[model samples]
Target: MDKSSGTVGVFTAADVAVFSVMLAVSVGIGVYSSYLELRYRSRALRQVITGALLINICIYMSFCLYAPSLALATVTNLSTSASILIVGTICTFYITIGGVRAVVYNDVPQTVLMFLGVLIVVLLVCKETVGAAEVWEAAGEGSRLEFFNMDPSPYVRHTFFSTIVLGAFVMLYWVGVSQAPHQRFISVSTLPTAQG
Candidate 1:
């Protein structure tokens, strides 16, 4: 409870319900994957059943890993302990049983769903405030929308050259060197198959 107001806390009943639902859904997905595994014992079929890499990057970036798990939990209207428990237990189970293949497969859809959630939040915010145009302007009110900053100054944070050119090199280097990407890369047989 909050000391001053005697309010219960950040997470309301609704928040708990939502978080519970999310955890339950993840558990269901895991169970379903297991069912798929048991039903199709063929190694060839299992390889095709799997997915992409580093989807956990979204989680790490969004949830900030161990230290900020509490803060991230609070933001999501979950208690710190509950958040940690849900993520830790569920992920361990999937990865343990399914291995990196499970991680990669799950990451693909989870990343898509994460973005979809963000898009929903954006739409809701726009509805609550003003239209999408106002939201766009508000984003630009800060310099976040400045993608084409052509400044050559090293001190400048987000010059077009720095973001587009340097960021490409960084991405290329990461793709080349990152263990997660390489694992995902080799999971597929051919470039065309992977692309498809």
Candidate 2:
């Protein structure tokens, strides 16, 4: 007997409903914009979409910059809100001045640093423990190593089939439909270069 009502795994029904509405709205906007482009041959709608997307990016980036300060504040016993404000302001200043090219350039170094940090943590964990074999054993015992579950039920989450299907859909949407990737790809000198 489950104690939780209308909640499945990490998401509640309300969460699903909200996301569904958001997805519907996004699809509706995209379809409308495409129709306007095709029928009217007007770039005005496209400009509006671009402006809205830029605003969305700014808000999303602000949150991304602020999130790390929560952990930093907890560790240092400082004010999380102050840290977030400082970090967010600095990020906003750079983003406002440097623009998308700056973002693309920064992403490479940020990705490298993230991977290096993960490697260091893994090395430290292995050093303090019995190593990879023991870690694997523990993970297996905790059912964390079940990577090949091929459950065909839609109700079942994190199954191999669901993971593959969802991952493919997400990748397709992000690469083909999302404005950010579309803009980045087209910003290249030539079509062949962008395709490559």
What TM-score, over all chains together, does every model reach? 0.54, 0.65
lDDT of every model, 2 decimals = 0.59, 0.65
CA error at residue 73 for candidate 2, angstroms:
2.4
lDDT of 1: 0.59
List, residue by residue over 1-196, the lDDT tens digit for candidate 2.
1244633233344533543443334434333245335433457755675677679778876677667888778788679888887777887799789875676667768999999999999888887899978878888899888778889998887999999999987885565455566444434445554334
Q: Candidate 2, residue 7: CA error in Å?
A: 37
Q: Mark the 10 consecutive residues where model 1 has the least summed lDDT.
A: 24-33
As a whole number from 0 to 100, the lDDT of residue 98 in candidate 2 is: 84
For each of the candidates, give the backbone clash count. Answer: 0, 0
Candidate 1 lDDT tens digits, 1-196: 3465455423345533443343323333332223334444444433443432235355554564465567668789888888877777766797789876666667768899989999999889999987989988988897568766789887889787778878876774455333345555556555565445
Each model's RMSD to truth, in Å? 20.8, 11.8
TM-score of decoy 1: 0.54
